[model samples]
Target: MQPKKKIYIALKFIIPAIIFLISIGFVSKKQEEKLCKKIVITIENQQGNFFINEGDIMDKVTKNGREMVVNLPFDNVKLKDIEQRIEALKFVQSAQVYRDLQGNMLIDAVQARPIARVFNPVGKDYYISDRGEILPVSERFTARVMVLSGSFFRPYLEKNLLIDQAGKDLFNFIQFIEKDKFWSAQFAQLEVNKSGMINIYPQVTKQIIEFGSVADYSEKLSKLKIFYDKILPDRGWNRYERVNLQFKDQIICE
Candidate 1:
């Protein structure tokens, strides 16, 4: 083949490749410029009952300042950093920050579901999430979940989550009551005494349920259910001021 003909053929391929690369670079630059326009925050509170709002997430994103990431360059907005900031919120269970194809910064977040609220004698309040995580109460919103009070020590309150065995037991108990249709509405509060004995306060009946310990809670609660469904209706709700289910196999009514 002639050298001139070889050079012409090489140019045909090289020129298109250069044009393609340049076009790709231009399109990418335009897309990035579009992404730097505005940020869109979307809060996915699936149940609509969770405490976190879009503003709560935005507060973390901006740190209550405009220059942080809002209306800033797309490359400057770190999705991982935003996610970490949102997840740091006590109520937030998980968060995801990303950029869509439309060059818009999108933030999706989920709030932790609180199963119960714990009120200590020292006036400190904490929320026990469904996953057994202990979170501080929100200042903006108060969750009307089950309230637990009495004798929780400092060690239990110091951590952001339940680490001790006793705390875990209490967490499990509250979670169980919250999940159960009959118990969730029936029980109003849970009290843990210094002796680690658990006491349940009912919503409807004045009778106090003495649940001694957390072990065998299912069996103990089942016995109590029998008393409420079978015995209480016939005997009258107020007939027994206290119902004890601490024993091995007995529902002692007094």
Candidate 2:
């Protein structure tokens, strides 16, 4: 082919490509300039927890008694800022914010699941999330979870409880009960004494479970399970006033 013909073919393709690129940029700029017309908030409550509601999330996204994203331009709406504001709520585990092509802002939030409710001796009450996050008790809702009460957990009210080994052990012990179907239903509360010994209370039974410290919790629980499965069936649930699993290779019942 001749040099002029070759140049003509190259220009034909390059010119259209440049035009398409510019058209895309212009459309994107127009989209950004458009005003947000609507806001949609969705709260995921698969766990049936009502700690936070739609109104609470809207309050966080609103400023000065107005919705931040509704009347603002797409470019001015900070999605990350909105997300951070929603996630700041004690019950919200995570939040996501974004804009749709229809000039509407959408927010999706997941609420935290409380594994245990802790009532300290100093009158500080809180909830411990499954991820070890300390959450404040909500006046609107109460979770049906295991309870923890005692002076041993009082120091954690003012500081990060999950940072220390003792705290971690306590959290792990709660997790163990929460994970087990039978134990979670049987046990209602765990009390830590001054000497760091743990006593568990059952919902149906009248006996106290002297679970000792958090050390060897798995083995202790195993023994307790055996007692329930084998001994309780024959001796009856109320046969013993207290069941001690602190001893090695022996279950002391009284």
Candidate 3:
């Protein structure tokens, strides 16, 4: 090709590239100058409760008792700060704040789901989230979940419960029960002894279930189900005061 033809071809590509960069910068500048006309907050609660609301999030997205998102330019809105403030709430699992092309500030937050309510011996009652996070009890709403108590839970107050082996077993046990429709409805409360042995209190039956350690819990629960399905039907519900499922493949009733 001739030198003049090659130069024309290069200019054709470079000129459009420069114009594209300028167009992007101009659009970004316009977006920054745009004022936020509305604020939209969305809370994801598929597995969560009404522990946090729109008003609660709005309280965090403010400066000196005044709303900071609406009526402010996009450049002035501190989206990161707003997200951090909302996520600081006890029930909030995560938060995301961003501005759209329509000059609207949007905030999306996910709330933690409580799987069990723990009534510790120290008198500090709190809820355990599905992910094993310790959440403060909300006065605004009460969740109907499995109740866990006893002296064995004291260590969780000072240290991270989810990290410990015993805590992981306990969490898994609770998940197992929660997933089972019959077991979840039958058992209401659980008490753990110093040796980590769990005692279950049934909602319909008066007999106490001696569920020894979290080890082989699935097998023990399976045996307990057999007792309920076969033995309890023939021997009456109140025939035994205690049902021991500690021994492997055995249901000791008294």
By lDDT, the best candidate is 3
Instruction: Report the error of model 1 at residue 137, Å.
Output: 2.1
Compose the digit string of candidate 2's lDDT tens values, residues 156-238.
77455588888888888889889999899999899997667999999999999999998998899889989989999999989
User: Which consecutive 10 residues in model 3 have the weakest lDDT in total?
Assistant: 63-72
Regions of model 2 farther than 4 Å from truth: 1-33
Residue-wise C-alpha lDDT for candidate 3, range 194-227, written one tens digit per residue: 7789999999989999998999988988999998
Cα-lDDT of candidate 3: 0.87
- lDDT, residue 239, candidate 2: 91
List lDDT for all candidates, in order: 0.81, 0.86, 0.87
lDDT, residue 13, model 1? 100
By TM-score: ranked, best first: 3, 2, 1
RMSD of 3: 8.0
For model 2, which pairs clash?
A: none
TM-score of each model, in listed order: 0.82, 0.83, 0.84
What residue runs in model 3 are displaced by over 4 Å at the alpha carbon?
A: 1-33, 46-48
